[model samples]
Target: MTLSISARFAFETDQPTDVLLQFEAAAIPEQRIGKANTSLTQAEHCARVPAEDDIGERIWLRSQGRFDVEYSAEVTIERLLPDLGTLEALSPHEMPGEAVKYMLDSRYCPADSFQSFVEGEFGGTLGGARVDAIRQWIADHFDYAPGSSHVNTTARDSFIERRGICRDFAHVLVTLARASTIPARYVACYAPRVEPQDFHAVAEVFLADPTVEGGGAWHIVDATGMADPAFTAKIGVGRDAADVSFLTSFGPSNFLFSEVRVEKL
Candidate 1:
């Protein structure tokens, strides 16, 4: 499937501010790209930084006064959904070195705090069954309220409040999976049919497949149930939202407006 994605950001700053932006589609093996462009108004000293995951790329820029940035891309992506029934949770020692980190706690997803709860609820279930149960549990309990969660909201906070956005949902799911000894990570994506047409957050779990030689594969999971896997374009992967935020500013900058549009072709 091919998708056209575009985003615009406007900000106002009293003095020059340094900004790090990760708004581009990731260059994963499953995705192909055509012509793409990015522009920044009233900005100086812009540079591109390769992401640690070797997937998405980030842009750093310095801007003063009124600043505007627009990015547009044409991408074709192949969605690969895992066969849940054939997946199993691997032991910590069996997991790859890179996958081991995801099983640990992060800033937003404190897996240790939820160990008892996760074990009590999902101890008996293993593999894809456990993942499906976790997804359903979150979707059933949490209310998808936009203004209910803040940047500092953690999985425990969202669990107690029973409300949050896509990122919050992903955080809670990732935490619970990790608590159950499952390797899970957060994913930033451009999802089609998202009501608000904004960047989306999802989760991916490394499930052990008997057929695979080493260990297993990362399976895309959306606890929020808002994104269509077939139309989603991955932007980045990380332990949590902190590592994959679309934009970050070092100095105080008033966000004027932002907009995202995705079209299927």
Candidate 2:
């Protein structure tokens, strides 16, 4: 399937502020970028940097004063996602080196804290089954309340609050998967049908699957359940949202506005 994305945001800064951005659809094996265009109003310097695992690129820009950004892209995604309940979890010892870092606790996703929770709530389930259960638990128990969470909000925070936005939901799923010994990472992407659509995030877990080329494959698990995996176009993967945020400013700034639109083409 193909997707069209259009995003625009503006802000004002005091000095020459350093900013990092990761907002383009990644050109990975399963997703291909057909065309992309980006424009900055007052960028003094801008360069492209590889994102985590080199799955995508981030923009490094230095600018000051009021700034405006416009980005648009067309992407085609060709992934045959399997049922999350049908995939099996792999043993930690069997995981590849690249998947090890994702299994550890991260800034936004403290996997260690959720160890007992998973063991107790999902004791009988293993592998993909446990992931499905976790996702379901979150969707059933929490509310997708916009403005309910801030940038500093973590998985533990959202757990106690029982509410958060897409980033919070993704963080919770990533934390739970790691605590369950499944290599999980956060994903930044664009998808159609997201309520009040803007930027979107989801969790991807490494699972054992014989049908794929490798012994294991990564499967998307959206706790919010708003974005379907097969139709989702991933922008990048990271330990958490911090690593894949569309914008990260280095100094004080006033965010004026942001608008995002995603649609199936």
Candidate 3:
């Protein structure tokens, strides 16, 4: 069975920003059963109406953006539980649970940073509790305020600051995940609910086939909505937020006023 959902996405930035919009998924992820597609106007202001073949699982429109400017992408999710085993086996020691060497080597994710409170206290490997721990920590420690940090805010900065937006939250998670020997990546996209799409962040962990979760193995964890209830729908994932940031402007510009409004429609 599959489910279908349609929504509109819109946003404004504080300054003139170039944006890169992504709305594509490798395949369905985890329990998310079916797939859906989208249609939009030429100007990319509105999402016409989405279409779906089967109707069952939680199907909805997702988007991602950055500071570039006006940008958007319409994506569909087909087959929620994708065969991540292949990717898991192929990915190097970039994420968690695969290798401590690479994780330790990373200047961003040091060995000391990962703690028992993250592993034993949390639960299993990065695939299990790592993502949750980061989410909980960010929610508990940080304050949801923009302008706290700029685009250059590093993982360490966010951790020490304990106050940032979605991008900062994702960087912190990525840093921690790497410390735990988990091959983690970054993702950026839009969360479409009642209103338009807005920028969001998340982390992904690569693990071997455990002979469980239906497939031989799978990658799990979406921190975008972990701290906040507003970001419900999943949109995209990558090596980091930078990889998925929409709108890459060529020249220099300035921002007049930027704002984002989202509501279920």
lDDT of 2 by residue, 1-265 (tens): 8998999998888999998888888899998888899888858998999999998899898999998989899989888677779788888888999999999999999999889999999999999999999999999999999999999999999999999999999999999999999999999988897899888999999997758654898888889989998789898999999899988999898899989999999
lDDT of 1 by residue, 1-265 (tens): 9999999988877988898888889878778877799888857768889864677898888888888889899989875666765677787888878898899999999999898998788777888889989999999899999989998999999999999999999999999999888999999999878878898999999897555666687888899898877778888889999988888889998989989999998
Q: Ranking by TM-score, best first?
A: 2, 1, 3
> Which stretches of model 3 miss by more than 4 angstroms?
1-127, 193-197, 208-220, 224-236, 255-265
Displacement of the residue 259 alpha carbon in candidate 3, Å: 6.9
Best by lDDT: 2
Position 154, candidate 2: lDDT: 97
The alpha-carbon root-mean-square deviation between model 2 and the true structure, to one decimal in Å, is 1.2
In terms of lDDT, the poorest run of 10 residues in model 2 is: 208-217
Could you tell which candidate, 2 or 3, scores higher by TM-score? 2
List TM-scores for all candidates, in order.
Answer: 0.95, 0.97, 0.54
List the global CA lDDT of all models.
0.87, 0.91, 0.46
Best by TM-score: 2
